[model samples]
Target chain A: MVAENKGIEPGGGIVLDGISHAYSGRKALDNVSLTVPRGESMALLGPNGAGKSTLLNILCGLIRPDAGRAIVAGVDVSKHSSEARQNIGVVFQDDSLDDRLSAWENLEFHGLVYGMDKPSRARRIDEVLALVELSEWAENPVRTFSGGMKRRLEIARALMHEPRILILDEPTVGLDAQTRAKIWSYLNQQRRERDLSVFVTTHYIEEAESCEAICVIDHGKVQVQGPPADLKARYGTSLIRCLPRSPEVRQKLLEKYPEAQRLSGDRLGIVVRDQAMIDAFLSEFGSSLKEILIDEPSLETVFLAITGREMRERDEVNSKARGKRNKRI
Target chain B: MSKLTILGRGIYAIWLREIMRSFRDRGQLIGGVSRPIIWLLILGIGLNPYFRGEIYGEVRFVIPFTYLQFLFPAVIVLNIMYTSILFAVSMIWDREFGFLREVLVSPLPKWAILFGKILGGSTVATMHGFLVLILARFADVTLGWDQVAWALVLMFLLSFGLTSFGVILAARVRSFEGFGVFSNTIILPLYFLSSSVFPLDPSLTRTQTAATYPEWLAMLVQINPITYAVDALRGALIGFNQFDPWIGPSIIGAGAVLFFFIALVDFKRQ
Candidate 1:
C-alpha cells in the first residue's frame, strides 16, 4: 500500500480514524476523529488541553495513537512517517525559526532536510520569501525580525518544500488583530493559489468561522462538527437583547419570552430565530424596553449553544490539565 | 536521488548549519580556542620548575622534557572535551526555540539528525584542537609533521567520543539552565577524574610500577576513558609511555561508537 503511492498526490488530504491517546494514565484524546478534504480549510477549535495537541502529534507522527490510525496525504503516518511527513508541512505554536540563521539560510536548511537539491532550494527560498513579503529581509538574521515578520518567515519556511497539506497550531495566537488579519489574508491567498489543504486549530471562534468546516473539541472529545453557517443556523440564527425600563416590564418580558436570559448589568439576552421574530418581539415589548439590540448570531453564540459551556470556562478547566501534563512531560 | 544521497544531504545540512552558527558567534569561537592557550601559558609555565626533569624521565626515558610538553596534549584534550560538550548543549536551545520541532518533523530519520549534530560538534572541536596546537612550538616541543598528523587523528577520536557523550546528556534536557547544571556536574568531574591536568599512574622510579600509586585515584584514572585520550595524544606529540599506545585510540574509538548509538536511541525516543 505504501509503495503504491511513493509520492503523495496534490489532491490528497488527511484522515484520522478513531484516534485515541493518553499521557501519564490520563486520556488526552478520546476517540477523536477528523478529516480535511483536498483543497479545503478546516478548523479544529479547542481550548488548551482539549486534545488538539495530541491529535496534531498523532497526525505529524510524533506520537502514536493508542487505538487508531492517522493517514496523511494517502500514507499511514504511523507505518510510514517519513513518507507521510513529506506530504505535510507544519507551523508549530512555538517559534521554530533559528534566531541566529538568516531567513534564507533557515529556509535553505529546511529544504535540504527535505532532500531538495541546491538549485531547487535556492529557487524555492527566493519564491517563498517573496510569497511572505520577506524578500527584503532574506539576508537578515531571524532574531532581528519583528514578531509578525518572524511568523511570516515561519510560514514561508513551512512552505519551502510545497507539501500538499499545511497544519498550523494556533498560528495567530499572540499577534495583534491587524497582524492576525494579515496572516489570514496571506494564508487564504496561498490556499487558493496553490490549492492546498489547511488544517488549523485555533481558540478564536471568528477565525474558525472563516474556515469551510469547524470541529469544536473540549475535554479530549469533539463536541460538535459542521459548517459554521449550518451550526449557527441550527443552534442560533439571531440574538435579541434589551434593557428594561421597570421591574414590572422586566417580569413581563421574561414571562412573554421564556428563553430570554438576564445578561450582565441589567440587560436581557434572547435567541431569536429570525428577523421577523425579532421585529415581532420589539412590537410587543417596544415601549416597555429602554433599549433593544438585535443582530445576527456570532460563532461564539453558536459555540456556547452547542457546548453548553463558555469558551473561557473550558479554557480554565483545560489549563489545569495542561499544567499537570506539562509538569509530567 | 537515492536514499543514501538524501540521508547524506540531510546530515550535511544539519552539520553545515551548526558550523555556521558556531562561526557567527565570534565570542564562542574565540573563547573555545583561548581558554586552553591561557592554561598552557599560565599553568604550564608556573608548574614547570617543580616537576620538570625527573618526572617524565622515569616514565618515558627521555631527558630535559619540561612539564609544558607533558601539559600540552592534556590542554588539547581539555579543549576538545569542553568544546564538544558545550556544542551538544545547543540541543537544549534548539528545543526551547522550537527549531527542534522542524528537525523532528522532517522526512529525515531521528538517528540521522543526531548523527549530524555529533559529526558537526566533533569536527568543530577537533579543528579547535588543531588551532590550539599552534602554541605547542612555544612549549619547546619539536613539531614533526608526522606527530602533528597523528595528534589530529587522536584528537578527532577523542572529540567524537566526548561529543557523543554530550549528546546523550543533552538529548533529554528541556532547558538551558537544566543542561548547564547537568553539564557542569558531569563534565568537571569527568575532566578532573581523567588525566587531563595530572598524569595517571606516573612512574616515580625505575623499578616501581603503577601499583605504588594511590589506590582510589589509580582506580579512577584506570576507569576514565579520557585518560587514554590524553595518554595517546602525549604519545603522538612526544615520545611517552604510561600504557600501551594503542589503548587510548581503541578505548576512545569504541567509546565514540557506543555513545553515538546511545544518543541515537535517546533521540528516537524523544
Candidate 2:
C-alpha cells in the first residue's frame, strides 16, 4: 500500500492518516486526519496547544507521529523524509534566516542547499528577490531589514527552491494590515503561477477566511473541516439581539423563547434560524423591544459554536503546553 | 546530475556560509591575530632567559633549543585549540537563533550538514594556526616550505578533531553564558595538561625529570590526546619528538574520525 501511494496523481499535496503523537505522557495530537489536495490552500485553524504544532512537526519531517502515516507529495515523511522534503518547502514560526548574510546571500544559500545549478541559483535568486520587491536591499544584511522585509525575504527564500507544496506556520501573526495583505498577495501569486499546494496553519479567523478550505482543531481533535461558506452556514449562528424597554416584556419574551439568552447591557439574544423566525420575532415584540440588532454568521461564530470555549481563557494553559511540547525533540 | 553531485552542492553551500560568516566576524579575526602574538612575542621572549635547568651552579639538563624556538610550535597548537574549540559559538548561534531549522529542513542528510560545518571550522582553524607559522622566522626556527606544508596537514586534522569536540560541547550546553566557564575549564586544562607549554618527557634523565616535574603530571600529559597533537606539530615545525613519532599522527587521525561520528550521533538526535 505504501509503495502504491508513492508519486501518485495529485502528488503536490499532503495526507495524514490517523496521525497521533504524544510528548512524554500528554497527547499533543490524537488520531488526527486531514488532506490538502494539489493546488489548494487550506488553513489549519487552532489556538495554541490545539495540536497544530505537533501536526506541523510531523508534516515537515521534524518529528515522526507515534502512530499512523504522514505522506507529503506521495512520500511517507517518516520513511522517506529526504524525498518528501525535496517536494516541500517550509517557513517556520521563528525567524530562520542568517542575519549576518545579505538578502541575496540567504536566498543563494537556499538555492544551493536545494541543489540548484549555479546558473539557476543566480537566476532564481534574482527572480525571488524581485518577486518580494527586495531587489534593492539584496546586498543589505538581513539584520538591517524591517520585520516585514525579513518576512518577505523568508517567503522568497521558501519559494526559491520551487517546491510543489509550501507549508507556512503562522506566516503573518504580528504584521500590520497592509503588510499582511501584501504577504497574502505574494502567496496567492505563487499559487496562481505554479499551482502550488499552499498549506498554512493560523489562529486568525479573518485570515483563514481567505483560504479555499478551513480545518478547525481544538484539544488535539479536529472539530470541523469544510469550505469557509459551508462551515459558517452549518454551525455558525445568526443572533437577533432584543433590548426590552420593560421587565414585564423581558419576562414574556424569556417565557415564549426558552433559548433566548439574557445578554449584558439589558438585552436578550436569540439564535434566529431563518427569515420566518426573524419575522415572527418582529411581529410579536416589535413594540415591546426598544432596540434590535442582527449578528450575521461568520467563521468567527462558527469557531465559537464548534469549540464552545473562549480563546482568552485558554491562553495560559495553551502557552504552557506549547512551551513544554516545544522542548521535546 | 547524479545524486552525489546534488548532495555535494548542499554541503558546499553550508560550508560557504560558515566561511563567509567567519570573514565578517572582525572580533574573531582580532582574537585569532592577537592570541598568537601575545603567547609567542611577549610570553616567549619574557621567559626565554630563565628557561635553562640549572642546579648548584651547574646546568642539570639542556633542552637543545632556545625558549622561543621551543615555545613557537606550542603557541601554534594553542592558537589552533582556541579557534577550533570556540567554533562551538557558531553552532550555538545557529541552534539558538533558529538558523539551524533552515538547514534541518533541507533535503540533505544530517551528516552532510555537520560535515560541511566541521570542514568550515577546521579550515578557519587551520588558517589561524598558519598565522603563527608565518612568524616562525622571528622565533629563530627556520623551516623549509615542505615543513610548513606538512604542519598544515597535521594542523588541519587536529582542528577537525577539536571542532568536532566543539560540536559535542554545543549539544550538551544549553546557553552561551555557560561557554565562558566551559573554555576556562576544558580548553585551559587540556592545553596546560597536554604539555604544550611545559615539556614533560618520560625519556628525560631520571634526575632531570624527578627534580622538575611530578609523576602525576607526566601521567596526565601522556594520557592527553592533545599531547600527541602538539607533539606532531612540534615534530613538523621544529623536528622535535618527545614520544614515538607515529603516536602523534595516530592519535590525531583516530580522534578526527572518532569525535566526528560521536558528534554526528548528537546531531541526528537533534
Candidate 3:
C-alpha cells in the first residue's frame, strides 16, 4: 500500500492521513486528511479555530498528532521527525527572527544549523535575500526593519537551506495590500523557479484564490476541497440584491422566490440554486427593487454555509468565551 | 558531515548566536557584571577593618590577603548564578516570542539545544568572572599560577553546575514572572545557605543548623560542588585548606557531572 501511494507521485510532496489532534480535551483536528501533490500550491483556508494551525504544526513536525500519519518529502514526520524537518522549511505566523541579530547573521546561523557549509551558506544567504528583495537590508538589525521587511526576512531565512517543501502558516496576516501582493508575487515566482511545493494557510479569501488548489476547512474538518475555479463553479451562483425598503416587501420577495437563500435583511443575498429563478422574480418586482447586485458565491459564503456562522461572528464568539473564561479564573 | 557532526555544528551555531545576542545588548551585559563588581569594591573595603580587629584574644584576620581573595570565588559563583538566571529570562522570552518552537523543530537533538544554551550562558558567566578577576588583580590582589588555575577550574565547574541548574528551572517554568519567583525563592537561598559567603565550620551551633535541615542540605554543602569550589579557591588564594585534602574536589567534580545529567534528562522530557 505504501509503494502504491508512492507510485502516484514520483517526486516530493506532503500527505496527511487520518490526522487527529486535541488540546486539553478540546478537539482541534478531527481526522483531517489532505494530499498536496508535487509542484502544486495548496491553500488551507479556514476561519479561526478550524485547526489549520494545528495541522500545519503536525506537517512541520512541531507537534505529534494523536492519531494519524504525516508523510513529508517521503519521510514520516511523526516517526522520523528530524529527517522530515530537514527536507521542509516552515514560516511561522509569528515573527521568529532574532531581533538583535543582523539579517545576514540570522540567515547564516540558520544555514549552519541546517548543515550547510560556509561557502554555500554565504552564497545561499545572498540568493535568498535577493529573492525576497532584502539584499540591501541584510546587514541591518532585524529590529530596525518594518513589519513587512521582517516578514520578508523570515521567508529568506526559511528558504536558506533550499528545502523542497515550504510551509507558511498565515504568512500575510498583518500587512498592507502592497506588501502582501509583493510577498505573493515573490512566493509565486519562487514556486515557479524552484518547482517548490507550497502549503499555506490563510483566513483571507483573496489569498486563497491564488493557490492551485484550496481546502476550505471549518471546525476541524474540510468543508470543500478542489481547484479554486472548480469549487467556485460548483457552489457559486449570481448574487441578487433587492432592497424592498421594508420588512413587508422583504417578506413578499422571499415568498416570491422561496428557493433563493436570504443572505441579509432579505435585500442583499445570493441565489445559490438557479439564476433564472432570481431573474423571473426580479422581473415581477423589478420596479420595487431599490438596487440589484450579482456576483459568484465567495469563499466567505461557503464558510458560512458550512459552519452555520459568519467568520467574524465566530471570532467574536470565541473572543467572548475566552474573555469569560479568563474572567472566571 | 556525519549526523553527530552536523548536530555539534548546529549546537555551536546556536551558542554563538546566544553570545552575540548577549553582547549586542550592551546595557544588559554591563549591568549584569556591575552588581558583583560593586560588592567586591565596597564590601571588601568596608569589612577589612572588622576582619582585622581582635576578637576573643585572637587576632581576627580577614584571611590576610587582598580584597580579591575574599571576593574572587564568591564573585565567580555569583556571576554564574546571575548570568544563568538572565539566560533563563531570555529562554522565557523565546517561549513567548515563538523562537523556542523554531529551535525545537530543528533537526538538532534536544540535548544539543539544551546543552548549547547552558554552555553559551556558562561562557558569558565565565567571561564575566574572569573580568572581575582581572579587575581584582588591578586592585592589588596577587595571584600565583596555582591560584589562577584553581580559580579557572572552579569558575568553569561552577558555571557548568549553575547553568545546568538554571536550565532545569527554565524548562520547568512557564512564565517570566514564575521564573522571577523561582529565582528569588531558590537562587538567593541557595547562595546564602551554602558556604559561598561564610565558612562552614563543624562548630556545634553550625552543625546543629546543618542537622536541623534535610541531610541533603549539609551533604550537598559538604559535597556541594560550590563548597569545594570555594575551598579550592580559598586554598589557592588565602592558603587555607578548609575541606578534606582530596575528597572535596572529587565530590564537586562528581556532583557537577550528576547535575549535568539531570539537566539533560529534564530537557529531553520537556
Candidate 4:
C-alpha cells in the first residue's frame, strides 16, 4: 500500500496497472496498462467496444476492475474512491448537466458538492463561466443552450474545482468541425495555463496528434503507445505512392525506387524515412508517372500500419460479436 | 474543509434546490394544498351529518371533536403522505437526465445524498401541511399556539418518514410511469388502511367492549405506521387519539430510521 495524501494534491496523473475487467462472463478490458505522467496530456484512441469507456470509468472511480490497480492522482480508486474523486474531474460522454437548472445554478450545485465555500464557489463560478465565454448565458437554463454552449459549460463545470487531472470521455464527439476545433484549442490552452494533466478519449485521429502521448487501443488491448512521432517512426516515417501509366513505367519506377512494394495493379508504394527522400522522389518521378503522391506519417497512418486493420472495421466486428453475446445472455 | 462541513454543504445544496424548485412550481404548490382543501370542505361537510349526533358507548379510543374536526388531521396526513411519495419521482427524473451521475461521482458521502433528499422532500411536504393548517379555522377547529407547535413537529416527523420510504422506493425505480404505478398501488392502500380518513372505532360494537372496530381492521391500522402519525397529529391538534401519545412518535421515528438506512444502502450500491 502506497502512502496516500489526505487532501487535494497537485499533478499526480492516472496510473492503471494490468487492469482487467469483465462484464457477465466476457472480458471488457484485458490487461490494460497505461500512464499519464504529471501535467502531460494523453489521448486514448480506440474503436467502439474497444474498452475506452471501461478504462475511463475505472479512472474516474465509477467502476472497479476485477483484477488490478487503478490509482488516480495517488489515491487507489478501488480502496478510496471518494478520496480519489477529490483530485480528479470528469466530463462524461453523456449529457450529465441538469437541464432544469440555470448555468450558474449548475455550477453552484457542483461547487457545493465539491465542498467549496460560498465566497470561493461564487468567485470560481464567475471565473469559469467567463473562461468558457458563457458569462452572458449564466442565468439561462442549460436546456436553452446550443450543443456547443452546453458542451463548453460542461467543460467549465468540470474545471470548477481546478482538478489536477481532467478525464474527458470523447469531449468533442458529435460537434461541428469548428466547434471541435474550438474545444481542442481551449483544452490546449487550459493545459498550458494550468499545467494540468489530461487523459482524454477521442475518435478523431487528427485532433489526437496534438497530445503529448497517444495510446491506440483495439479489441480490449493497446496496439501501440508512445509519443506521436515515435510511434509514426516505428512504423514508417512517410508513404510515397506512384501510379504508373503502363507496365513499362511501373518497372522503371520500381528500378528507381527499389524498395517500392507493388500496390494494386500498376501502382507502387514506398516508405520514406525522411523529408529529403520524399522531396527527391517527387522531384525525379514527378513527370514519369501519371500521378505521384507523398503523404506525411499521420496518427491515422500509424494506427493503420500497426493494427493491420482499420479502426472502423474493428468496431464493426466487435459490435457484431457483442450483439451475439447479448443475444445469448 | 472538514468532512462534516462537506456533508453539511451537500445537504444544504440539495435542500435548497428542492425548496427553490418546489416554490417555483406553481402547479405542484397549488395541487399539494388544494387537494386536501377540497377534501376538507366538500367531503368533511358532506360526511358530518352521518356522525353529527351519533355516539358509541364508553371506549378507550375515540375522536372527541365534531366529524369535520375529526377529519382535519387525517386530511393533512393524506396530503403529507402524497407529497412525500410524489417527491421521490424527482429521483427518477434525475436519473433520466443524467444528473444523478454527477451527484454520485462527487466526494460527498452516499448517506448525505439520501439524507439531504429526505430533508428536502420533508421540508416541502411539511410546508404543504402548514398551508393546510391555515384551513383549520374554516373547518371550525380552534388550536392554541402550543398545539400548533406540537402539530408542526408531528407534521415534520411524518413527512420525514414518508419521504424516506419514498426515497427507498425511488432508488429502485427507473421511470416516472413506473414510480407512479408503484406508489399508487402501494401508497393509496397504505393511506386507506391507516385509518386516516375514518375513525378506528366503528359506530356499533359487537361483543367487544374497549373499541368497536373489526379485529382485522384494527390489526392493520395498528400495524400501519401512518396510522400512528395521523393519530399523533390528531392528539396534538384536537387532544384525541386512537393510540397512546408516545406510541405514534416512537414507531414512526423507528420506521423513519429503517427507511433511511434502506435508502442509504441502495444508493451506495448504485
| Top candidate (lDDT) | 2
Q: lDDT tens string, model 1, A1-329?
A: 53444244534777777888888899998988777777888998766677888888888889988998888877899999998888888999989999899888899899999999999998999998888899999999988999999899989888889988899998987777678888898888888988788999886666787899988888889888888888777775456657899998999888988877666457777877776876788788888878666645666666656554444433443334224212221
What TM-scores do the predictions have? 0.86, 0.88, 0.85, 0.83
The reply for model 3, stretches above 4 Å from the true place, is A1-6, A239-271, A276-294, A310-329, B53-68, B138-140, B202-228, B245-255, B258-266
1 against 2, candidate with superior DockQ: 1
**Residues B105-186 of candidate 4: C-alpha lDDT, one tens digit per residue:** 7887777877887899999999998887999997788999999998898889888888988888887887888887898888
In order, the B-chain TM-scores come to: 0.89, 0.95, 0.82, 0.89
* lDDT, residue A149, candidate 1: 92
User: What ranges in model 4 sit over 4 Å off?
Assistant: A1-11, A235-297, A304-329, B53-63, B202-219
Report interface Cα RMSD per prediction: 0.6, 0.6, 1.2, 1.1
RMSD in order of candidates = 6.9, 6.8, 6.7, 8.4
| TM-score winner between candidates 1 and 2 | 2
- The residue-by-residue lDDT of candidate 3 on B1-270, one tens digit each, is 788778888989988977887888787678666866776777766655554434467765434544446655666666667776667777777778877777877787778888787788878877777777776564466777777887777677777777777777787888888887778787666666556655555552344356555666666667545566666656655565566656556655765688789988976765
- Tens-place lDDT digits, model 4, residues A262-324: 654456768777878767876776677786655566665576566543344324433342242
Ranking by TM-score: 2, 1, 3, 4
List DockQ, one per candidate, in order.
0.75, 0.74, 0.67, 0.55
Residue B267 deviation, candidate 2, in Å?
0.9
lDDT of 2 by residue, B1-270 (tens): 788988999999988988898889999899889988999999988988876776578963357678888889888888888998899999999999999999988989889999999999999999999999999988999999999899999999999999999999999998898986887798889888887877777565455678878778889988988889988988998888888888898899899999999999999887
Alpha carbon lDDT at B141, candidate 3:
67
Report how far residue B118 has shifted in candidate 4, in Å.
1.9
For candidate 3, lDDT tens digit of each residue in A150-247? 89988888877888899999898767768888988888888888888999987666777778898978878877888988876676544454567667
